[model samples]
Target: MDDLFAPATGAWQRVSPRLATVRRIVIAAIAAPVVIAGIVLAVLLPDQRWIGAAVTVATLPLAAWGGVWAGHNQRTWGYVENADDLLVTRGVMFKRLVAIPYGRMQFVDVQAGPLARAFGIATVTLHTASTETAADIPGLPSDEATRLRNRLTELGESRGAGL
Candidate 1:
């Protein structure tokens, strides 16, 4: 388990912890309302108290599990930029590893959503001619994301991989 999807040469570079925080926040933002409404529904409609309790019961544990899963999932994400390719590895139960050659890179993009921007984190995506090779590394500090995009772009250009 410790070496699942481990890089071949160097150690994997992990994404920021803020990625987990942002995911947890999003989960809470979505789940909190459901929980609150469940309680409110229970209070307002005593005759349907079971329905409200069911909603709360069903959502609370799932949301809690999502929060924990977010943390663990974030920890699982990692990437490494090798001499000729970039490798990304993620997932827990069902793991994935992606390797994209610099010569095959079409472009690199950096994106940040409202919450990610607030946390100064961004996602770096690599586009290739092959749809199967497209990949994204999320929860990188904004600066790092920018740097990675730029570096990948430069590498792609040098390798004549630019589209």
Candidate 2:
């Protein structure tokens, strides 16, 4: 059963280890404010103190769990490029494997949000004729993301020419 979720046997390139830190930071950034608000409300509103306290108590642990989960999830994301296709595998519980043929790629995009940019990581997205075929691989280093985008574009153009 564990083998089912393991990455395929090949030259699987793992995303940068720093991605885990980025995920934890993002989770904390989002969770901290909400928890703080709950705590403040608990102190300010005496009548609804119980509700606020409950919310604050419940959320803090959940937020920590989310950070841990994000770290683990980031570690799970990996990709491998073969002669004919690129394989991306992710998820720990509901594992998924997406195989995108080089010939099926229509375009490639590289993006980085403020948080990602600060972390020096970017996401590479692949577009195909079928919207369902489009895929994204996040948490790549900026330079690696650029190289991948260029490589995928080149491969897509050369391979898709026949299609």
Candidate 2 stretches greater than 4 Å from native:
1-9, 161-163
Q: What digit string (tens of lDDT, one per residue) describes model 1 on residues 43-127? A: 9999989888999999999999999999999998999999999999998898999999999999888899999999999999899
Per lDDT, the best of the predicted structures is: 1
- RMSD per model, one decimal: 1.3, 2.2
Please list all clashing residue pairs in model 1, or write none if there are none: none
lDDT of 2 by residue, 84-156 (tens): 8888878867878788899998788888898889889999998888877778999999999999988888898
The candidate scoring highest on TM-score is 1
Computed on alpha carbons, the lDDT of every model, listed in order, comes to 0.93, 0.83
Using all chains and alpha carbons, the TM-scores for the candidates as numbered come to: 0.95, 0.90
